[model samples]
Target: MTRVLNFLRRPFVLDLRALALLRIATAAVVLTDLAIRSTDLEAHYANMGILPLHVLYERNWNAYQVSLHNISGLWQIQALLFLVAAGFATMLLLGYKTRLATVVSWLLLVSLQNRNPIIGQGGDDLLRMLLFWGIFLPWGRMYSTDAGRTEPKPAAYSYFSAATVAYVVQLALVYWCTALLKNAPEWTTEGTAIYYALSLDQVLMPGGRILYQFPEVMRFLTFATYYTELLLPFVLFIPVGVPFWRMLFVVVMYGFHLGISLTLFVGLFFLINMASVLGLLPTPVMDWIDRQVRTRTQRLQPHLTRLSNWRSPVRVNVESSLNLPPKTIQILHGLRNAVVTLLLAYVCWWNLDSIANPSLTMSEPLRWFGYLFRTDQHWGMFAPAVFKDDGWYILDATTPKGRHIDLNRKGRPLTLAKPASVVSLFKNDRWRKYSENYLFVSNAYLRPYYCNYLLRVWNEDSDNAPVRRLDVIYMKEVSLPNYKVATPSREVLCSCETAPPAK
Candidate 1:
């Protein structure tokens, strides 16, 4: 029992520099995500957009799920919430009130994700989970404003805590679950998953097209991806080889994500995943970094001293008045530990249940708990099988003046040749996800909503010709082992007449 406790506590005995790096990386990701979402503020968050609050609630909401975005029907309120989230992200980056900032950022992210679940992918879930775990960490112990205010100097390493165990396990489960869920033969014997993925024009970037020409290389990568995810996570448990294995995992996984980013436009998925791996960087690396920083500071101290001598130093004193008794502090600490343990245990149970049965339904109370906290997780990325049908969308619109125009290009007919790259059509990951959702037959409702929204956007533009009618069309290419001459299928999803502009 003692050995088990010691083993579990090992991950929590982390270098402060590692935690500081994690803080910076996570904050950067949050800022980048908010900036991207801001570009399509009204289109994604408002009632006038593709997914209004009512529609979102009707389709995805349960008794327990809560969203600040759902509280208001107005776009301004949602925008304000987004701004506040950005502010929290900034605070987190600066390491000022880090725990509070982390909690607020996570809450806002959950609100935004629940507001329109359609626009989110695996990356959003990872980001939320990271922030959730971050709240319990001593991330502000070093390289932070809080650290500067302490009377006695803070330690260079953080004390062991249960939250550290949870963090490491959470990351391990991500890879393990993804690998287990990839039950398709292509991931094992056939090794054609990357081949099909690269062939999909919608998710593919320019580099993917160039890589698609080399079938053998794609096959090698497909096998590598599978084995890497399957085997690397288990390395976390090898106590004797922890450092070497962790360093290997970090390098290989970082490269894996880099390759994915180069070949596909997965929004912040790669970036967030990469950032999360920074937490696993071995202590030696962190120590080396600290040493280098110290050396640099020593080298610059003389110059800094001369510059400081030019101005009179101002001294300020700060004091803490509120103090809790030892007994009360012990009780509070126990309560916090109990709460964290329970949450971690529940999350573990959910992960196991999901792995055993992807379709398993939890009890109502458990389900409600997950919904309330937005802790529901699913890491199946291209599992079972990678999507073989890749396509682009073509919006055919009829003007109020009885003229037909392709909304993909202004003043162009619907018969124009498909663009070489469809990536330019989307502003960010949210738009990309929205387009991907439309490819599925079950998400048919998205067609009419998006068509109406597009028409409204066009009609609202006084500088452009007004559109009265719209059709949502999908042009798809089927992927096969060998390149063959095939005709693209054009399928019309839904048609709708534009509603008149609001007075």
Candidate 2:
């Protein structure tokens, strides 16, 4: 029975030092994401921006979702929250009060995403879920402020728990669910998914443009991508040659995501995915990394000592435990384990719903629980087929003197011609995501708000290019086979006229 239990736990054993690395990497990502989002505080998070608080409550907000950003619509308030979130992320990076920092960071991330659902993508979900599981992980057990100067024992190098299982299974589910949702022939037999994906000039990077010229290469890569997403995750749990299999999985995924990052404008999606698997690297690799780090630290010992002497000695000890009876402590631990197991099961069920089969459907009643924790996720990115409707926005506007201007080009003359690089038009990937959502028929209500926001932004210095009306135009370019390019059609997505200059 002991042997059997050990076998069962083998694949789930996580290297604690790797977990510590993951904690630091994830926290850095949180800080980077926050900094990027901060640039558009008024535009994305504030009420006077693209989505007002009332409009969000009416159209986009759900009952189970919560956001601290909802407390005030002002950019200053949003900035304050961003700063607070950044502070927590910093604490998490240093592993000072790690569990607490992780929990708060997860909360703020979910709140920020919920506040602007239109701008979210699969990466946001992955980041949120990683932090959620980190709350239960002993990632701060080594190489952290919480760990202090105490070195870990050999046994402490590895950890096995319900949270570790959840983390592993969660990553597998992301790839598997995304593959399952991509039932379209383009991802399977046709093998044109990559071709179409790269064809999207809106997201085309230099690598994609170069690769787009090679159709045969695209088809081969398309098959590789699909099969990798489908089959590679299972390698992570193989019992035989455990370390070899784990290393193979990690290496393959690193290349896979790196390939994606090179060919697409996915922003931090690849980085987050890559970070999610850092803790899954085999113990030997982590051991090597530890040795290298120790060597480097020794080299800098003198400098570090000087710096340490100048700074006041401050150790943020996070070691606190209840002095409960043995039986009570056991009960509490079991309860915590049970809750994690249950949550992991629920997350699987939630992901199953993405397959879109009625017989395999997860009950709606259980979803409120997932949403309450903000663990509800969808992995259908470029799935069921890549988006064929590729386009660039034209913020076509009319001046008070009836002159035509394009706010998207910063008050330049309005022209329907497509830009040289549509990807460059977006300020960041978040805005690119919002623009993608805006094209969806279901998101038609989002158009007027965006139009109004652009108009307001343009007219503040009305003397230069005062506008009476603004029209949000979309130039739709559908991907065609045989390397054919479809002619783009100009469609007026939204037209908003400002209330006649205070009458």
Candidate 3:
């Protein structure tokens, strides 16, 4: 027990400048989201369909107008929230009043999430949540607006560390639940999970039929994806053998996300998964990043060398004399070595299911698989499926309602007439690689939003058809350069092969 306490109290050290840089980078990314959304505020307001504050108030029989949606009155309040979030984000970047700033930053984030649940989308919310927690930690001890405020503030520091741990735990729980659910026989045996996904609208497709046609390749992909997820636990614990395995797993997972973006019209979901995985990037990768950054700074130093030297000799001497040795840095000294050690262990064990099964369902040990199969949701989104007396079957709805209805039966020509909005946004040259690459393989690769979209498209089509045979052929191609989001050609030709061979 004494040893454990000593370990928790162990001091850890890190470069203050690096933490500051990371803070700025993360803050800039968050700010960019605000900028993008703010520009489209009017359009978003009309389209987002948020639950109005007044509506809630009226429903609850409140007297005063509690609405936050009015253009005249609420606009300023909304702007203030954005400003506060932006201000705290800047303070976080500058390392100023980190403890207070972290709490305020999170409040701003929550306000935004609540304001327009749909428009302000992406894993940025989750990242902000985690960063908010980090803000309370000893993060500001180094590269912060408070970089010089290194005096011991035990209460503040304790709060920050606790927040950070809470964020970590939230991330672990998310991955664990997702991995636990993805295991299933259908995903393993036929690769049906991805096959149904491939026929979605063009935005979600990487390159149309070209990707899905390679049957053998798809099969291998199916196996590899599930297997890697299942083994996450084992790999996380093998300290001696872990480094290589973890690296490989990270690469594979990233590649899978990249594929989803390319093929599907999905990108945000990929970022969310990537954010959680950031916790797994071992210290070495971070060290390498730091080294590269330092080298670049060194290269630029020559330009400012003369100016630096022009400083008074006394100023230089005083600063040099006051510099603290690495061992003497109190923050590093105070880090409980046990906390770091236990944190790593918890990370490995908590999300073990992610390593064991990457999908949102379970497959092996048939006994437990049934429980997973019974669940309908996967990480806040449902799968693209239909109800049957036996079980649920997945379907594609991006094809025309007329033709998609026919394809439900097995072994049909799997062709579709030009869809009105089948083409993917990612497939366009404007976003190009940044868009389609993630959308294409998103479902198989674990891109959350895209997967949700897939599920929605499927479930929406449930009332439409019974299967026979469906083949769609387009009479004319669709082309319209002026429109940002162009739809596919509507001229569809469909036929049923499962019907009796016409005498």
Candidate 4:
């Protein structure tokens, strides 16, 4: 017990400057995101803020009425909570009262994220989780409000080891899982899946229709894509030949993401994936970048110096020329004022976001990055309508020949929805087994590329066809999972439209 107590209280040396900088940069980016999103507040409110935090709250409270926009809590009460959250976040950024502020900030952020339930569960959210884990590390030693602690550097090093590993491991897991999920039959079956996907107007690329003319290339790409996703996990881990393979993977991934951004219109997902490249980059890269900035600054310094000298005689030395406070007195006074201002500002910001809405803030980037936190991705097969049984809903996909071929309801087809009618489908036992897994789910999902390109589908209901709208749902991401993987937890909600009456 004494040993445990001592361990918890041990003094550690940490590079507070680096940690503080990371915190500040992350906060600034988040603040920018918040400002950009502020205008969409009404849209979010209409959908209950679309943040996952809100969903968690609604579930916990069993009260759907206490949502954003309609915010029913007393003004004073909400303000207090918001203040505490924001104040704690500021303290964390300034490296003051770190232990307490860290915990308080994490709780408040999580609370806020929960309030929205839909908006806060993305790559940024993952980073925030990682930041929380980093709080226990000795990151407050150098650039913090408590900068002058007399702790040994090695003491802080131990804390960093685990925290760093946790962040890296979690990030790797996300990629691995994503890759594994892309190996669906529709994605690998070659010319068939891409055919149907390109036909969908929303997902059309620049020359997608023209590219469809070459069926062979589509088939080749389908096979290449599956192997690429399947091999990436091993390439990332192995020691000798891994680096070369990983480089190839990077090229392919960047091309794929770029293509999606240009052609598919769903660029946000790709943008987030590309930003994740930062995880693989070491701090030395940032250091190198900083050095280059300094070099550039030095090159320009002489010119700036001459300009300053030229203006010196004419410019007023304001404070000194105006005969203001003496140097020593001013220095002391400035420091004192800074501390007071920081405290007050922290309080004000915390209350505005944390308490008032309890749906605005989230954990810092580092902590959330420690885990691959994502919502359910279980888009079932897309067709015109939906059909549901006890736990399963068999879906249909069409072929180019225009025949009604069903995998679950009728029989497996070789391709997805290309023909006006579903026919000539392909289904192996493995594919059939995996489709069964989606039986109980109710949200976005992905299946493997059996023939080529990721063939995505969703199973949902719509108000357009009240009675007959039980059809299969389909959409495509450029990739699919074709590797061994741990199946994800099933808790998805369907937003897919099922089969409906013919117009």
Compare the candidates by lDDT and give the number of the best one: 2
**Please, what are the lDDT tens digits per residue for candidate 2 over residues 57-139?**
99988898888999999999999999999999999987677778999999999899989888998999999999999998877
Q: Give the per-residue lDDT digits (tens) of candidate 1, residues 1-503.
A: 99987775664466566777788899999999988888788888888889877787777667787788888767888889989999999988877777789999999988888888888899888899989988887766655555544545443354456677778788888888888888899888899999888877778887788898998999999999998898888877676666787788789889999999999989899999999988777778977876776666776766544222111111111112236666776677677777888888888777777776756646666677877897778888998789887677788898877878888776576673677777877777788888888778778777777888888788788887878898878787677777652577888888999657799
Error of 1 at 324 (Å): 4.9
Worst 10 residues of 4 by lDDT: 449-458
Better lDDT candidate (2, 3): 2
**Residue 161 C-alpha lDDT in model 4:** 37
Q: How much is the lDDT of residue 25 in candidate 1?
A: 94
Q: How far is candidate 1 from the true structure (C-alpha RMSD, Å)?
A: 4.3
Q: Evaluate model 2: give its lDDT.
A: 0.85
Judging by TM-score, tell me the better candidate of 2 and 3: 2
lDDT of each: 0.79, 0.85, 0.43, 0.40
- Which segments of candidate 4 are over 4 A away from where they belong? 1-29, 46-109, 118-125, 136-160, 188-200, 203-228, 235-259, 266-268, 283-287, 297-503
| Model 1: lDDT to the true structure | 0.79
Clashing pairs in 1: none
Q: Give the winner by TM-score.
A: 2
lDDT winner, 1 or 3:
1
In model 3, the worst 10-residue window by lDDT is 384-393
Give the winner by lDDT: 1 or 4: 1
**Off by more than 4 A, model 3:** 1-25, 45-51, 55-73, 118-125, 142-145, 148-170, 183-185, 202-210, 237-249, 299-503
User: What TM value does model 4 have?
Assistant: 0.43
